[model samples]
Target: MRSVSIKELLTGKQLLQEITVNGWVRTFRSNRFIALNDGSTLHNIQCVVDFEKFDDAILKHVNTGAALKITGTLVESQGKGQSVEIQVRDIFVHGGADPEVYPIQPKKHSLEFLREKAHLRVRTNTFSAVMRVRSALAFAIHQYFRDNGFYYFHAPIITGSDAEGAGEMFRVTTLDEKNPPLKEDGTVDFKEDFFGKETNLTVSGQLEAEAYAMALGKVYTFGPTFRAENSNTSRHLAEFWMIEPEMAFYDLDANMDLAEDFIKYVIRYVLDHCEEDLKFLETRLLDEEKTKPQAERSEMALIEKLKFITDNNFKRVTYTEAIEILRNSSPNKKKKFQYLIDEWGADLQSEHERYLVEKHFKCPVILFDYPAKIKAFYMRLNEDGKTVRAMDILFPGIGEIVGGSQREERLDVLKQKMAALDIPEEELWWYLDLRKFGTAVHSGFGLGFERLVLFATGMGNIRDVIPFPRTPQNAEF
Candidate 1:
């Protein structure tokens, strides 16, 4: 008989047909019912066994986490939770998971515990739902960009330039670390290395995407990016996926519009397509939040929060205006902010961003025209010269979901900014060539893929969203 997935069994229109199904057993109770899941959906199909028909040895192996193939008759479930089930005819124990040795149990497992057992976590309901939603969201991202006339661009993973100028990069080297060849000046020579010069895992693909956008009119990149920063926060990860879209003739306003629409489109796509997984997650979040104080709880539920984003317009506020508001706000005046905003040039921290999005605006907020000194050198300088055309989209729980800016189209102005920042002009000669030749107003922004998942799934830690999180001193999986 052909094997049918448990998901297919659950959603089939007709029942009472003989079919073979393969899946891991979630639970075996009363030596009669087996909860089987194949990772196709959050729900499992019940498999009923008649103890008198099976041998004692075969029945002994029908425990949780065991792999099984069973030929059964699919029928409407008499059980309370599920709609359909299988009445088993023949059972094959593909693999027996010894209850004493199996890592995943039928009982509730904490998210942290699951993180440690990353290899087997997907067998659980929570991670399976998260990963399914994650996969659907990824497809939604590609679909949104493709539908909008943007060419998908593949930027190099190994790059010679530090696009963000953050100075935090994971060096890609084939040379010996302890001892290396030195030049005449006693400096380690990278010329003898793999690329004949220093190259690192890409921090951001924006620079290369910009190059492609100039030629291709519009392009987007979705790939892995590495960061060497030693931030051990719930939001930080050593390696992550990023979505960056660059366009040739767009300004900061257009960039902001695109970013908002793109986010909403993908979110709506996930809501529509991943209904079962998202519903599971929504219930999971609501149950998790029940432990918190009433004052600290979310005003809206997970589904409501997602729908709110799609229904409302993001509030756009200028950096100067935000500074004025923050300086006068009760939190700043009462000294509640960890990093008080007493001046205009100070960078906004997470506390400030959270206040703006969660409390003041009570929705997604776009903060634009940040101080030139705080932003990257490539961002276009406004007429005021003190601020750059940078915008960061802040969500209620997650601060700075997206960051982007309009590029400096003037060759002389870009060259001057590069010089002022002490960035090697020679290294970016090709990037400079874009401005040197036929540069028009262009804009783009980067969306952290993991963070986006966190927001969509209502996952608290950034680690929980990704399959295997790489963080400080922890690369176990």
Candidate 2:
């Protein structure tokens, strides 16, 4: 007989018919009822067994985490929780898991505990729902770009130059670690390396995407990015995914509009397609918040918050205005902030960003016109000569969901900025050539894929959203 997933059997396609199902047993209750899930959806199908007919030895193998194949007839469930169940006529144990040794028992486990068991964490309800939503969001991103007439550009994972100039890169080398070839200057020689020059995992695909966008007219890159920063915060990940979209003839305002629309579209997509997963996560969040203090709980329900974002426009503020608001705020006056906002050029910390988005504005906020020195060299310099046309979209829970800016198309200004920052001109000759030939006002932004999952699923840690989180001192899985 052809096997059907438990998800399909529960959706009411047909009833009172014999069928075969394959899945892992979530729980074996009363030795007669089985909860099975195959990762197709959040809900599980209940399977009832007639213990009097089956031998006790065969029934003992039906434990949590055990894989099973059951041939049964679907009928209306007599139980209260589920609408339908399977009456098993025959059962085969594909894989048996000992209850005493199985790590994923039928009980609540802490997120920290689950992190150690990253390989098997998805079997749990919380992690499974998160991954489902993550998958939906990824598909939505591609669909949005394709529907908007943007080509999906595949940027190289290995590159010779750091696009951000952040100086925290994981070098890719094939040289011997113990005895590397050294030059006359006492530095390791990279000429004999695989690429014949120093190369590393790409930190961002923005530069390469820009090249494609200039020719293709509109392009977007969705791929993995690496950063060797050792800071192990809840927000930082050693390896993560980035979504960068580059558009020709786009100004700062247009860039902001696209980002806002792109984000809401993805969220709405998940709401439409992953309703079951979202509902389970909402219940999980509500239950989790009961353990926290009353003041720390969320102001609105998870679904309500998502609806509010899609229904309203993000608040727009300038860097100067945000500075004024932060400097005069009660937290700054009372010395409550860890990093106080003292002047105009100071970079905004997470606390300051959250204040503007959650407390002051009470909605999503887009802050633009950052100081030139604080921003990257590629951002367009403003008329004031001190500020650049950079914008950061801050969400209520996530500090900076998207960061973007208009590129400096003027060849002289770009070269001067690069020279002032001591960036090697020879390495980026091709990039500079774009500005020299037909460069006409391009802009793009990068959205951290994990941050989006964190907001959508209401997961607390950034590591929880990703399957195998790469962090400092913790790359086991």
Model 2 per-residue lDDT tens digits across residues 145-200: 99999999989999999999999999999999999999999999999898999999
The reply for model 2, stretches above 4 Å from the true place, is none
lDDT of 1 by residue, 202-288 (tens): 999999999999999999999999999999989999999999999999999999999999999999988898888888999999999
Q: Could you tell me how far off, in angstroms, the CA of residue 156 lies in candidate 1 after the best superposition?
A: 0.7
Stretch of 10 with least lDDT, candidate 2: 5-14
Q: List the residue pairs that clash in candidate 1.
A: none
Predicted candidate 2: what Cα RMSD to the true structure?
Answer: 1.3
TM-score, predicted candidate 2 vs. hidden true structure: 0.98
